[model samples]
Target: MTNTDVGITDDEGSTMTLGEGRTPLIPSTHDENLYYKHEGLNPSGSFKDRGTALTVSKALEEGIEKLHVCSSGNAALSLAVYTRRAGLECVCHVPEQTSESKKQLMEALGATLVEYDGVYEDIFHELREKDLDGWNVTPGVSNTSLEAYERIAAEILAQVVPEQVIVPCGNGTNLAGIWRGFEKHGESPAMVGVQMKGAAPIKKALEEEKSHAVVEDPGESLAEGIIASESFNCAEATDAITASDGRLEVITETELEAGLRELVREGILPEPTSAAVKPVADRYDGVTVAVVTGSGLKNYTELRELC
Candidate 1:
C-alpha cells in the first residue's frame, strides 16, 4: 500500500504531507537476521510523526483551530511540526526538566511551550481541567495517535516477518498500536517492550504476569523519551502483550549507552530511548526487528557532550 493509503486525511483531502511513514528496515551488522526499523528518518525526526500527522489531520477536518499536548519531547516536536504545517496553533506542555534541544525545537516550529513545574502527569491533570479550544493530541489519550502507529506494523510485515518485534515503551502506545496492527493483518509476532530500569511500570507488570499496571516513581535515565511514572494506556498495552505472549525488558543506563554507541558505529544513530531495544534484540535467537523510534539529532546536544 502507498504511504498516503496508510494515513488519515481531511475532508478537503489534506494530510500532514511531510512524508511520515515507510521507513527502511535495515539489517543489523551484528546479526544479519536482526533488523532495525528506522523510524528516526521520519520527516520530523521521530516515530511520533506518524501519530501527529494523523492527529493534526483530524483536527483540521474537525475545524479545530488549536491543539495541545503534554509531552517529554518527541511527541511535542512532532505535534508542533504538523500543527504548524496545517495552520493550527499548537501548545506543548512540557516538564521543567525536558531537554533543552527539544524545547528549542518545539518553539522553533512555532509551538507555545508551557513549562510545567512537575512531571508529565501533573501537566495532564492541569490540561484536563482547562478548557482548551482544540484537540488534545496526547499519545495514549488521543484515539487517533495509536491508530497511526499501526502503519509501522503494517510496513514491517510488508518488508519482513520477524519472529519477534521490540520497541521502547513510554505510555505503551506504540506497543499497543503495533500489536493491534499485527492482529489486523492476522500476524502475531512476539512483542517485547523495553524501558529503563527505574521507571518501568509496564516491565514490572509484565514480569508479574499482571493484567493491570502499577504506577511508580520515574527515575533518571539517558533514555528520557521512555521514562514514565504511569503509562496513559497501560491497560491496553498489557492486554496486547498478554495476548501476544509477549514480555517486557528493562535496560540499565550503561546498557543503553553502549547500545546507542553500537548503533551509531553501525551508521544507525538513534536516540538513547530507541537504543534500549538493542540489548533485548541481541538475546533473541530467531529473526528479530527492533524499532528505533527517534533520531539522534533530537538529542544532538547531549550526544555531542557524550562524544
Candidate 2:
C-alpha cells in the first residue's frame, strides 16, 4: 500500500515511482484459482483513488481550490477524500437515496454534501447551470477520471496477466482508462464489462449496435454505483470493448447478491458494486481478476443485512 511496494519499468528503461498500486490479488474460495483484485483495500476504500489521486494532484498543480462533483457514491467519496487531502474544498452533489455511510464518509473527509431529491444526472444538469467562478467540476468520466483509471489495467497486467479483465461498468471511465492503460503498456488483456441486468446500458448498446441512453430503472439493486440514467460515453466504452475483443454482459441482482455473500464468507468485504464482478467470473477460462471496487465499510449495515 506504499510507493515502494510495486514495480514499474518504462519503455525507455526509466521508471516512475509507483503509487499504492499493487493491491492483493487473492484467490477466490469458491472458484478454483480465480482471483479478486481487492480494490476495497485502496486508500480511498475504492478503486477511484488510483485516478482521483492523479486528478487531484493535477488540480493542485493547476492551483484550483474548490471543486464540485456528482455521484451515487464511490466516486464522490473518493474525490472528496482526495480533495481534502490536497487542501482543496469539494462540494459533492449526491442523490437523496445515497447511503448514509457514504454521506458520513464525505462529511468526515470535510467535503460538503448537497443532497438533491433526484438522480445524479439530474443533479449534474443542475450543476451545469450554475455559474462557477473558478471551481473545477470533476467531469465524471470524460475528464481526468478517465486517465486516472488507466492504472487499474496497469496493475492487472503486472499481477494477474489475465486473458480477460471483468469490471462493473458504470460511468465508463474505468473501462476506458483500463483499456488505454493496457494498450499503452503493450499489455492487451481482453476487457469484459459487467452491469446490472436492469441497468445494462453497455450491453444493450452492444446488442442493438447503436448508442442509446439508458432510462433509469425504478427497481433497485445493491449495485447502486453503476446506475446511470443516461450515459454520454456509452458508445466510446463499447468501442473500447469491441476493439479489445471483449464482450459486455448483464448480471441479475440475484447473482450479484450471491456474489456479495460469497465474498463476505471468504472474508473479502466488498460493496455491492464490487460484487457485480462475481457472475461474470466464470466466463474466462484462464486467469481472471474482478476489480472489487469498493469497501464494505462504505455500506456496512446494508451489505451486512444483505448477507
Candidate 3:
C-alpha cells in the first residue's frame, strides 16, 4: 500500500503526496526470519518524511504559510522538503552539533536553519518562548506527526507478523506511534526501543519504572539522532513498551559502529542511529523486525571516515 492510503487528509480533502510510506521489509541475511524495515528509502531519506508529509498537508489545508520545528537533523530536513512542496516557509532550530550535511540539505531545501548552542530540548524551549506563529512540526511535540508514524507499524504487520518490533528511540514518538498502530489491529507485538549507551533516557525510565522520563545529560555518541535528554512522548512510549511486554536496550558507540559495518556487509547501508537496534536483535529468538530509520548518506562524511 502507498503512503496516501495511510496518511491523513485535511478538512479540504487534500492529502500530501511524497511516496513516504510502504518501505521495503527485507529479510536479514544474519537470520532467516529476522527482517529490516528500510525506512531510509523514503523520499527525504528518513522516517521523518512520514510525519512531515501529514503535518505539511494539514498546514496547507489550514493556510498556514510558515512552519517551525526543532530537530537534530532528519526531522528538519523532512520538514524543509515537505514545507517547500506545500509552498510554505520552513524554519528550523537545530543543535549546534548537528551535522554539516544535514544543515546543508535543510538550507538547500529553502529552510531557514538556526543553529542553537544547546541540545534539542533547549532549542525546543527557546522556540516555545519565541511563540512562533506557525505550525510546529516537531514529531513528538506535535500530535499530528504521531499519526504518520503509526502507519509504519501497520505496514509492518501487513508485510509480516513479527514477534518483536525494534526501533531507535529519540523523542519516543516513533516507538509510541508504532504501538498505537498495532493497537488498531488488536495486536501487541513486543516493542523494543534502542538508544545509545550514554544517552538513553527511555532506557533509564524503563529500568527505573518512572512515570516520566528522568532527565540526565545525554553524553556524546555517533548515534546523534537518538540522543535526547528528554523525550516529549516519554510517558506514552514507556506505557506502550510496558503494555507490549517490551524492554529498552542500549548499545555503546563501538557496538553501533560494528552494527553499521554488519549492515554494510549485508549490503544494507544505514545511518548509525538506525543500526543501534542491531545489537538487541540477537537477544530475541522469534521473528524480529528492526526499523532502520535513516540513510547513511546523510552521514556520509562521518561514515566514510569511520570506514
Using TM-score, give the best candidate's number: 3
Clashing residue pair totals per candidate (backbone < 3 A): 0, 0, 0
Give the TM-scores of the predictions, in the order they appear: 0.93, 0.89, 0.94
What tens-digit string does per-residue lDDT give for candidate 3 at 1-307? 4434443333212287677887899999879979999999998999988888878888878889999999999999989888888788999889989989999999999999999888888888777777677877776668776777887877887667889999999988888988998888778899999987767788778878885675577877788889878777888889999999999888888888888888878888898889887878878989899999999999998778776
Model 2, 216-298: lDDT tens digits are 57356778888766655677688889889999877887898888888899888998888888878876688887888888988
Clash count, candidate 1? 0
Clashing pairs for predicted structure model 3, backbone only: none
Which scores greater on TM-score, model 1 or model 3? 3
Model 1: how large is the Cα RMSD against the reference?
Answer: 2.8
- Candidate number with the higher TM-score (1 or 2): 1
Pairs of residues at least 3 apart in sequence or in different chains that clash in candidate 2: none
Error of 3 at 218 (Å): 1.3
Clashing pairs in 1: none
Pick by lDDT: which candidate is best? 3
lDDT of 3: 0.84
